[model samples]
Target: MSTFDYAITRTLDAPADKVWQAWTIADDYGKWASAEEVVLDVRPGGAWSSVMVLPDGTRIPLSGSYVEVVENKRLVMGMDVPGRDEPVLMNLELAADGEATKITLSQTFDTAEDRDQAEQGSNFLLDSLTAHLAA
Candidate 1:
């Protein structure tokens, strides 16, 4: 655990492959991921961007790239947020938990404030993912 890092774990009632698809595929990602418009190139070093639309129609743009990608197992990405000088590194790990999949999400930021702010959004995004997977 780094100085400015946070981890969240969730058990989703879906296979790892399905969860991976939800995270990587553009259309599937739009259903969750807390973004209205999403562009994802899931391969290593590929481009990743999305616009999260607020209820008031405000769009917050996020850009990033896949630092490491392991299909159905793990994904690590460098995510750029506004006001951050460096990209935040996000690691998502998936493993089998009987009929469900266990997802552990970790994010490393430059400062504690940045990490705390990002943590809120991460929780919302994962909650969205949980609903999407159940549906």
Candidate 2:
């Protein structure tokens, strides 16, 4: 099995609390998550949904379950893409850095292909989030 790791860091102008709220609050999350169709149930065992609209307008649905959550600190979830037999674990970390916040999103999978796909997808979403947070 192959493994891959990818990380992106953004210095948000807002404080850590604001950035944490942006991630935990449903309305704020939808604004930055980048999927045309998105849903977030932020509690443990809550369900989440995201439909990414491709450049050609094709909608890709992603569904998942939140397995763990720590207020203002971390979020752990299991994500399942269409046609994928196994769910991938998603771990998000939030930290305060002076007036800025450092957020980390990591995905671990059983296979290399899964890890690769996750890196690409997370990169795209993180880029969108950076723009959103900056604005």
Candidate 3:
């Protein structure tokens, strides 16, 4: 099995702590993640789950467990994907940039096709995050 890794970095007009809250807090996550339900436990070994409503009205269930969590700094999690023997590892890092926050999101997949698709989805998600912050 080949490993395909994808990463994206973007700066948001919010502080690191605020950005962290947006990710770590269930209610805040639901607002930006297009999830009608969100359950987040932001700690190592903690579990998180959500039901994402797609544009076409498809509801996809996603669950993950945290591998590492550092307040306002980093979060690493393994996401369970259907039909996969292994979970995809996602790593997020945040840095304070004046009044803004710089976030880098990385994920490892089994194929380039998956990686490419994830990249596009991630960009859309980040855009949603930006809009959420602005609101």
Candidate 4:
């Protein structure tokens, strides 16, 4: 099984701590994650899950386990996506940029098609996060 990588970076207008909370805290995560339900245990070896309801009402279930966690700095997880034989490695890094936060999200996928498909959804997630922060 060959793997490919996809990454997206965004500088958010919120502090690193706040951005970290928005991601680690279940409530804040659900606000921008486009998921109907969210469960997060933010520690190494902890578990997380979410059910995302699509625009047409299709529900997709996603689950993962934390591989590494660094408060306000970095997080690494293995995400179990539907129709995939293996979990994808997702790495998130946060850095303080003045009063704001710079986030770099990278995901490893099984194929270039998978990487391309995820790029759109990942962008939407970031856009949603930006809006959620502004609110």
Candidate 5:
């Protein structure tokens, strides 16, 4: 199986703990993750799921599980679409940069095509996070 990875880093206007909370809490997550609704259980082995309502009212489901978690520091998860067999791995790292938080998000996909397919959505999600932090 072919594999590919993508990584993005952003400086958030919030503290590390606050940024972490934005990711681990369902309601906070929706403010940036582009989800109309979300359900996130942040502990290891816990479920991460959400439904995103598009502009045309189409709801897309995203589901995942936390494989590893370290509060305010790092989180890793196994993520995939409902009907897809492609394995997706996501890792998020947070660090303090003065009063701001530096966030690094990395994703690995089973195939280059799979990684390419998710590029736009991944960027959009991270961009939303940055905007949320600014607000």
Candidate 6:
């Protein structure tokens, strides 16, 4: 099998610490992890789960590992979305840029389908995060 990857970058008006908090805290992720509503179990081997319940309702569970957690700097993990049995690697970097934070997400998947799902899912989450951080 071949591997595929997708990446996205976002700049938040908030500081790196703030952005890191938003990404790490369950309560904060509940606010930013989706364009709608989501439930994230943000622990070492917990869940990276979600339920889209605004405009529509859908429940999707993803599996992963909190491979790395570097406070306000970086986070690396693995994820396997619904219907897929293989987990992909997800790396998130949070860097300070003056008064703002630059967030970059890179996802590596085992196949095209996995890559596609990651792209769609990550973009959705980014959109939600943008809205959440803006507020």
Identify the leading candidate in terms of TM-score.
3
Give per-residue CA lDDT, model 4, range 3-117, as digits (tens). Answer: 8888899999999999999989998888788886799999999999999877788999989999999999999988887777867878899999999999999987767998988
Candidate 2 regions exceeding 4 Å error are 82-85
Best by lDDT: 3
By descending lDDT, how would the candidates be arranged?
Answer: 3, 4, 1, 5, 2, 6
Evaluate model 5: give its TM-score.
Answer: 0.89
Off by over 4 Å in 5: 82-87
Error of 2 at 29 (Å): 2.5
| Clash-forming residue pairs, model 5 | none
Per residue, candidate 1 scores C-alpha lDDT tens digits across 1-135 of 558889999999998989999999999998786686689999998999998886678888888999999999999999876777877789999998877999999987767987898899889889889999988
Candidate 3 is scored at a TM of 0.95
Give Cα distance to truth, residue 18, candidate 4, Å. Answer: 0.8
- Stretches off by above 4 angstroms in model 4 are 82-85
C-alpha TM-score for every candidate: 0.91, 0.82, 0.95, 0.92, 0.89, 0.79
lDDT string, candidate 6, 1-135, tens digits = 777988899898888888887877767876666423444555566566544444445554444667677788988877665676766678899889998988898987677886897788778877888788889
Local distance difference test, candidate 4: 0.89
- Give candidate 3 regions above 4 Å deviation: none
Q: Name the candidate, 2 or 6, with the larger TM-score value.
A: 2
* Candidate models: Cα lDDT each: 0.88, 0.77, 0.92, 0.89, 0.84, 0.74
Predicted structure 4, TM vs. truth: 0.92
Clash numbers, per candidate: 0, 0, 0, 0, 0, 0
- Please state every model's RMSD to the true fold in angstroms: 2.0, 2.2, 1.1, 1.6, 1.8, 2.9
Number of backbone clashes in candidate 4: 0
Question: By TM-score, how accurate is candidate 2?
Answer: 0.82
Model 1 lDDT, full chain set: 0.88
